[model samples]
Target chain A: MIIEGKQRIWADYQKEIADDHYFYVRSCIRQNFFPASEVTFWKIIRDYVHKDIFENEHHSSCSGIGYHSDVVPFTTTQAVVARQFALMTENGYKNLTSSCITSFGVYSEVLETWKNFPEELERTRDILYKATKREFEVPENVAHTSDLIFKYRNQINDMAKYRLVNVKTGEPLNGVEHIGCHYAKMFPSKGVGGAEHPYVLAGMIESWGGRVVDYPERRACCGFGFRQYFVQANRGYSVACTKRKFESMEPYKPDFILTNCPGCPYFLDRWQYVIAEMEGKTYGENGYGIPVLTYEELAGLVLGIDPWDLGLQMHQVSVEPLLDKMGISYDPVKKYLGVDNKNIGQPTCPSVLKV
Target chain B: MGKLYDMLKKDVRYQEALKACINCGTCSAICPAASFYCYDPLEIMEIVQSQNETQLEELLKSDKIWYCGECLSCSTRCPRGNTPGLLIMALRKLSQDTGLFVESEKGRQQLALKRAIGDNIVRTGYCIYIDTMKPERHPESGPVYEWIYNNRDEVMKRMGANYKGDGPGPMRNIPQETLDEIKKIFDLSGGTELFENIEKYSEQKAKEMGLQFDETTDCEYFNEIFTKTTKKHTL
Candidate 1:
């Protein structure tokens, strides 16, 4: 691969992510999949960086999943997205940032579609007015939550208690950075480093002292193909896609996988256990699976946040092994404790993955 | 040019996706679904470009259109800038609208998606509700999901989520009025019609196939589409 050519392409695809004051939207599945990652993004942006990121309680999903699944019509999806813009306009926020990569792609695609088809935009406006009586003005800028975190990675690293390095070895940990296909594949310029080599997650890894592993399948999908996984019978295709990625990256022996998308982390993390169960083969060292983490959890970790607080314990592939390698301290007794300090109970251990 | 081509040409997705087909096989080579399944975007695009109603009808009624993962990787690599993924979306919608989707094993799975993601959006205002994510139903969520599913309230609360509580934050309770607006939007924007057609056609197919049909997900037809997989799908 030509490094200079990739660098030239990356330079061309840099988008203008907003500096501050944004409207935040939640992912439909991210909260359920990685609840704390979204919460951590809010914490780091509001509590840590002191930015004005506003969210509306009444604002619902953008209907991207349903739209992509081919069940919801394009007109309905656009109208639902218009309602979100209406919420943002009503609340007086211009810049929009979403927690889910699919939602990010939806926002980008809708904006592009409106730019291309003025009649469709007008139709959507009428549909929103007829249904919700809401009028919307599109935001000035749209960005994924990772862009915001990447924008402030240096600031976060300044306050970090630990870097992305093994304390004992004094060597930087290798992080396999996976980009969600929708983040830029639909429109390359919508992402920080374009579709082929997205720097949104890589920038954060580099800023936090980690080596980005460019595996053969670095640009491959994590296989959260909405319907592919949603339907029970079609899961072989989903799992096989993920298995192809895991196999490609296994030779690199990366310490962990870093992901910006909500579904990427969940699938990359859980599918390891699934692959192990199906094939009796583990990807990590010594029968352990590679720990997959979202960008928010990684940022929270380096910033001296508790692993449990970042919802690390909720993962199928345990983060404890990585924590040990990083020399981060945590009390194992509190792993499954509730906010009330009661035991929330542990899951029955799988025979394959050593979680 | 035939009636099927005329109908396909009306869709915005068809207009946007089909610029021209040089048939370089770039899309099929880059497609993830093509890697594991007996699917080829280039072949599908060629069939659409041919505008043969016989071939187009066969393509629509077969599992071909349904095999797309919708990752749109094909959209990125097409030398002609023709998005076969979007074309598949247009075809899938056509298949569903014409009641031809239930003819194929995979096309019939649209009923499952309509029930799962479609109904979830109308009811909860989210595509995948936290409450509906049961471990028994979604075992691929991994073994640890049982713990998370059981202690969801406490776990979510601990993680600073609203966790079914009212007001703003992740997984917060979407107001009933908001859900009503969503349902109305779907009703006005052809979503409800699309959903109804799925059920209508699926029930007809169920009757023809000697499977029991019902309004709920517990019926035999839903089970058949939800769990049935043929060896033909794999490479």
Candidate 2:
């Protein structure tokens, strides 16, 4: 739903042709906390995918996090949507792609409701147009990166040339894929499959030669949005959800866990460590712990990209066990410094190229 | 008219709190926490609704009760709008009051942290404070001299006397009276003894179970021990 970073990569690979024009909506959380992930995603798209894809930076966050928490007013949300739509039109990239699931869910809901109710849209449009000297119509094309990635699964699979061999346990590395809540629940029809059992990310993992483990809390939220961990420490609720996933996947003894959304990774990575502490437990056959990884990072590893090049070590949870499981020697400092110039084996465009 | 049930009825803001179920199994069907273990939210809700103290006591004593992750998916998707998540919290509070499940090493350890937080909050309007922020040799390891030496500023900050101390403020608002009340409650709930016996009891139990106990106060080592132990138990 929120089409940021890894989701965008999935979309580009799925769509095959790089999208030149994009309504590059921003997220407050990502902008402040994970600016690099956002910037890197766009750079990858611009450098490797179609350079013609429209990129606009005028949109603000959807304010869904605040809105859902009952902190922000509904009027504020409507205003945000109105302004975002206007920005999309102004940038000549009416097609919108959300990097954050919450933003995608909010934008889609607002646009869908607006299209069905002219009076509501007109009232909001009047306020926005008067303020910005521009008008907007909810564009026909609006989707999360997941939608685009799922559409071109075969192409991505074909392009993936390398295979990651697990050095530990003498077995190939397996993963548990976490498709974020917004991507699945916000638009059921547009989703890859049943929202409860979405398999887009899992399918991709399988194609990439990794096994996808079915976890009990596979579909549950990572509890990041609730801020349950910080607000209500040691309540057992936040970690319980995480524990369910760990236990469910424990049977398979996954080498690493993959998630598309950054928020999920943040919570899963950090909270898994906390849960282990609270419960007084270790994971894996040899007390190895599970590492939360982004889909791109996992793909990069499988593609033989250096760990630091993929930013694998930046995660709060240690990826040492995962690297050991995959039998890859990782140098955190070097991996962090190395950049993927080839951008997942996609072609880079020269400045002379036209959109 | 137990305090737990009364609190749930009066304080829980969700609309589903009012819905009465006929011992239906639907909530359990979708409960993620229930999927792995034997605990069932529907069953827990039934016990609470019944107001049967015996059933409630039996439910509270089991390790299954602590498995809830509080995802609220059950609350959101319940056909009858019953929130097992809230019910579980109420049950945990009751369990703490009864001292039924506090004997377990993990439970005792939690009580220790809770007491530490409570005592520190009462004393300085904050949680635990040390001379430095660096990991020290755990108390069992005899006064982590190296950690104390290396991280004096961090320890001072944690002590609540420093400018950057994570003591109570405008937001966390841990008043002295509240801290005293919490400490009193902890004593009544046998939390003091639980906290005292954690390291001793956990080491013995972990050894019995063929687990290692590295009781280093070095925050990092304790963290590693805690994680390793919990992962083994959970998996």
Docking class of 2: incorrect
Mind giving the per-residue lDDT tens digits that candidate 1 earns over B1-235?
Answer: 8888898898888989989789999999999998888888888988998888999999989988888898999888888888898999999999999999999999899999999889999898889986777787778888788888887888889888898889998899999999999999999999999999999999999999999999777799999999888648878
Please give, for residues A1-355, the per-residue lDDT of candidate 1 as tens digits: 7999977856787889999999999998788878899989999999988899999998898899999999999889999999999999999999999988889998998898899989999999999999999999999999999999999999998888989999999999999999888999989889997876679999999999999998788888888788899999988888889999999999998999999888888888888888888889999998999999999999998998999999998899988878988889998989888986887788889899887
Which model scores highest in lDDT? 1
True contacts kept of 2: 0.02
TM-score, chain A, candidate 1: 0.97
How large a fraction of the reference contact set does each model reproduce?
Answer: 0.87, 0.02
What DockQ would you assign to candidate 2? 0.03
Candidate 1 Cα errors over 4 Å, as ranges? A1-11
Q: Judging by TM-score against the true structure, name the best candidate.
A: 1
Q: What is every candidate's alpha-carbon RMSD to the true fold? A: 1.9, 15.5
Q: Write the per-residue lDDT of candidate 2 for residues A1-355, one digit (tens) a residue.
A: 5668757645533322224466666544343223344444544445434344454323334546543432233344565566667767777765776666667666765665566555657766665555455577676577665444444445555655444446545555677788776664544444555465566677767776677777666777665433233223332445566666677777777777777664677667655555555564655555435787765556555545565545443454567767665666666434222133212121122122110
- In order of listing, the candidates' clash counts read 0, 44
